[model samples]
Target chain A: MQIRPLYDRVIVKRIEAQRTTASGIVIPDSAAEKPEQGEIVAVGSGRLLQDGTLRPLQLEVGDRVLFGKYAGQTVKVDGEELLVMREEDVMGVLEADAGTTRKAA
Target chain B: MQIRPLYDRVIVKRIEAQRTTASGIVIPDSAAEKPEQGEIVAVGSGRLLQDGTLRPLQLEVGDRVLFGKYAGQTVKVDGEELLVMREEDVMGVLEADAGTTRKAA
Candidate 1:
């Protein structure tokens, strides 16, 4: 079953932190409390205003974004872990160059 | 000097939790982590939608409301402590009957 977020919410799949250094040193991600990176899988139409008008979200699907480590609600979708959070929880979008540098092969 | 909250933000003056019971037993409110009650001192015009529409706030000055204990930023306005927070941080408005029961002299 597919889950669609409502009203300015978005679905995100976290990109796991790199576990190894370039010099071949293995580092653990669990100990550090840091911002998390994710790719937007789905986005709501927009924010619901009091006047009933929908304000479109600045984010779009497939966008790479950064958010606080503790932001958003975690849900299991088809055995895959995904996050559901409001668009405001997202800090910023990652540019093409920055995102490509961190792309996992 | 009066403080006018920005869009969707409200200024609140917290009502100190009752320090004494009916039987005249004194109690401290610091230990218990609980929702706080406040009176709206000022309100913003409304939420600013992405399209630049300003949706008016539901709250008004003199309205008593409930909010989370940790919600909002504390500021000293005119030597009096006040809170500045978005309207969403408020849980609900306290009706007249309920508000009178806790009214302090």
Candidate 2:
């Protein structure tokens, strides 16, 4: 199935919740919680402002992002899981290349 | 438990996944998947750009928004479920007052 989100919306493939922690602890999927991250698969052109012009997303396809557990609309595209959500739902592009990991304070 | 998200992040309470369709078809929570919508409860100052300036969010507290299914970090605050995610993780503020329900294209 083909999918496209309109106006600053994005389609994401959730990085399945981790099956293990940093210390080699095994966490079963059923026992594992949903993840807060994902890989960007598709993106909308950006948000359309009240003025009718588009303010495109700063992020590009393939950017790693962190989102809320219950953020986007659930859809099964081509039998693969996908999320259809707004660009605003995305908090920021994860700077994996930044070499510094940050946590919520 | 007290919760705070850092930099351009926001916390939301997922509007519980619907147990029924808009037309009254009951869908179980387990049979039902997670929800795509939520109520904004907390927010961060904003994203810090490369220039070291803050790019604050346009949204304020209490806005209804649409987010991805598996977007933010899951947490239970005061026994209520919450998602601690970045503001950028938010795609956009849901305009519940706008009177138009937009669907993904």
The numbered model that scores best in DockQ is 2
What DockQ results do all the predictions give, each relative to the true complex?
0.02, 0.05
- How well does each candidate superpose onto the true structure, as a TM-score? 0.45, 0.47
Tens digits of per-residue lDDT, candidate 1, A1-105, equal: 444454566778898776777899877767644449999877765677656566767887889999998988665544677777889999988895654454331
Mind giving the per-residue lDDT tens digits that candidate 2 earns over A1-105? 678778878888888755778999988867877776777888887566666666656556897676677889989977888888876676555442421133321
For residues B4-101, could you state the per-residue lDDT of candidate 2 as single tens digits?
34467777878876576889988877776777888877666557554434566655568788887778777654456777776766777766376466
N/CA/C clash count, model 1? 0
Please identify model 2 stretches exceeding 4 Å from their true place. A21-26, A99-105, B1-105
The per-model lDDT (C-alpha) reads: 0.73, 0.68
Clashing pairs in 1: none
DockQ of 2: 0.05
Against the true structure, whose TM-score is highest?
A: 2
Stretches of candidate 1 above 4 Å error? A1-47, A50-105, B21-25, B28-35, B97-105
